[model samples]
Target: MTSDTPEARSALRDSASRTLRLEQQAIAALVERLDAGFDRACELILACQGRVVVTGMGKSGHVAGKIAATLASTGTPAFFVHPGEASHGDLGMITPGDVVLALSNSGETAEVTALLPLLKRMKVPLISMTGRPASTLARHAEAHLDAGVEREACPLDLAPTASTTAALALGDALAVALLESRGFTAEDFALSHPGGSLGKRLLLRVGDLMHSGERLPRVALGSPLRDALLEITRQGLGFTCVVAPDGTLAGVYTDGDLRRTLDQHSDLSGLSVDAVMTRPGKRVSPETLAAEAVRLMEDHRISALAVVDEAGRPVGALHMHDLLASGVI
Candidate 1:
């Protein structure tokens, strides 16, 4: 077999090196271009009464969708509407109160730029991100962000690489700036993501999951062991809470305790719950986060905890199943 000559290998290495170096230069160039127009874009979106509608064609379209998601998830109400779809029937989605964010490396993508007149006519503010400041898209936009890059990562500098990254980063910056200006909080984020882990952490409070009243398996401190077991079974929480006369949490009796107590005597009905209950049981407050409850349950290797009030009275109880069923786990 013929071996590659040193000259052939050197050419390949130089080509790869050039692509990497040019792409790095492109990113650096984009960093230098952030200015007043970028701030204008943020101001325009923040001033928008409706959602930010992001649109682009091809690679830019993919980035636009991601940017829209980031904006929606953070605080801004935004969604992606494809430029081609907008040309068809989706133009109706663009309202006068909405802000349109159009992305194009050349600022001349026919599919994206074709909707400019309609957007202008609807009186919707337009923010354009493009590599060419003199391009039609830039000149027509209410605010133009220069996402211009020095060169592509491709060896021939023909492919869309660094330009797309610059545009995506600019979109994120806009979303974050709007997020801060709106004073968006974690609760707002949870509202947008009701089914995700963030929602559980931020929105799912301990009171929402804790079993209360009769549903909370509870027995008086002096109750018989047999009666405590009955309460555990009827409540089906895997454990029964033992509270003092003043309603403060006194102790707990679990399924494991029943087994240990039963080994000594066949009849536990004569045994008082106070004599067998484990005192100072693991406890949490009604205001605690469900995520923190899960952590405590896992770290302590136990399920089912009594929820206490600020004054140390037993108000509720919670089990691992409660967290899983409530979508907080």
Candidate 2:
């Protein structure tokens, strides 16, 4: 119900600015509060023989779900369960081997608090996150992560604003700490995300995208220049591998070489490919990652490469076009 007047716009900006500032302050306050209690939570989860089951009510539920996902993706095995659902036989989903992470800003959410007795009987460990450390839920847990904020960013101090932001940031810090302690690598991260570009960069090998057998362009050492040119044209890789009499890679002649050679000599009646090829051309092995192959091609200013084996024999051919087609570019 505000107008388009400058005064109204300025008031709207002020509200947004205040909200951001309050949330920023909430996150900053968590820095010193991170102590041995945070370490205990990590140790409990890490030592557990099973998954970490996270549960919460209301806005805390949304934040709990995200925390579970981040933990699962990083290295910890975790999943989210609704507290309300837990009372309806879903409680059977949890077992003695699992650790529980319960979130409740007020620390006394009825749906969440009701699980305490059953969890205690099952002998499962509980880690509570709450704004009030002395609250019933926090007092019953093994580790209490204090996500308290001075006040809500909501002007009315009722809506979950700075509290949720603080909780989310604390969850992220926990996941990252576990990831570092586990020595997780990008390769490990890629394993968890195998369908995207990140996975392709780490998993796709040169052999997976190479052109081999009949599709590979190659010529013999004593072959005529016309034969090499024909193979290059037939394969459309813009280059041909010249093999020695022993079936080993001797050299390679590219389209660039062809253009340059033609500029210097027109009479090719007695010329062999060996005399005009680039010896020991830039090469790669089938085990190389397609991402690494892309770097090699770009580094050498060439569009194609000869895939060689340990015996110096050409096994296949790789082109920039092949990389592009495979979405590795």
Candidate 3:
């Protein structure tokens, strides 16, 4: 049972603080220990034409799966396989051309060490992350990354804690080094994660959200003020493009313009949009990034803008609402 008493809360806070410090110390120690083995591990993964097969057991397995995901998303292709499952026909998932990354705190987990001979028979290079340098798995590996920690953060000193943090940090360092070596870019990462927010930021374009074709609201250069208002109301975009006779954009009339028109004239005179519209109104090319469009809109205090062609003709229109729907705002 947990308690909210002052003494209990103080004890809880102290435990959390100690755990965080131990985990941080574990991660910090890895920096000084990174050596030739780390380089060789990167070299093996970079040279492999096949996917990287990462395997571990228990808590190490959980960290191994996360490392594999980070590797695949960052440019290297990798996947996780359970050591127990690999001995049960999943070994077929690994190819001779692939490299294997095995993690075990003791470096002697029976299920993990059992696969060493098979890996050698297949002539596949092995990269092992372990706390024990003299253990079987570490001795068999082509490159041995020492992810050892001084001690577990657990009060009982038995559970995997600091050791797991060290392994995970080491894995991230290896993956990032490989990412830079391979010239991985944000666009490449976005391609692999098109459904994510980073992908939306890097891959989404203005044309993808801007209204085009029949949905686009536009009016000729000398169109009547009533026509522009009707187009705006019909499209519900708060604005309509005003085009010249030669099909070039002349200006834009918006709800703001309508309010101004009402303020300047009391009589319903023969007013055309050319008389009240904003001349050479703000616009962007269809190829502009949606993020850039957001900046332009915010900077100009605009709620709606036009997408123009190279010749300055209206091809599409963008509204702040579309950006909101697309999660760009």
Candidate 1, after superposition: displacement of residue 308 in Å? 5.1
RMSD of each: 4.3, 2.0, 1.4
For candidate 1, what is the TM-score? Answer: 0.81
* Candidate 2, 195-285: lDDT as tens digits: 7788889999999989999988999998999999999999899999999999899999999999888888888767789888998888899
Clashing pairs in 1: none
Q: Per-residue lDDT tens digits of candidate 3, residues 233-279?
A: 99999999998999999999999988888998986459988999999
The 10-residue segment with the lowest total lDDT in model 2: 1-10
Clashes of 2: 0
If ranked by lDDT, best first, what sequence of candidates would result? Answer: 2, 3, 1
- Order candidates by TM-score, high to low: 3, 2, 1
Q: Which ten residues in a row have the lowest lDDT in candidate 1?
A: 1-10
Cα misplacement distance, residue 309 of candidate 3 (Å): 2.2
- If scored against the real structure, what TM-score would every candidate get? 0.81, 0.92, 0.96
Error of 1 at 173 (Å): 1.8
20 Cα displacement, candidate 2 (Å) = 1.1
Residue 36: error of model 3 in Å? 1.2
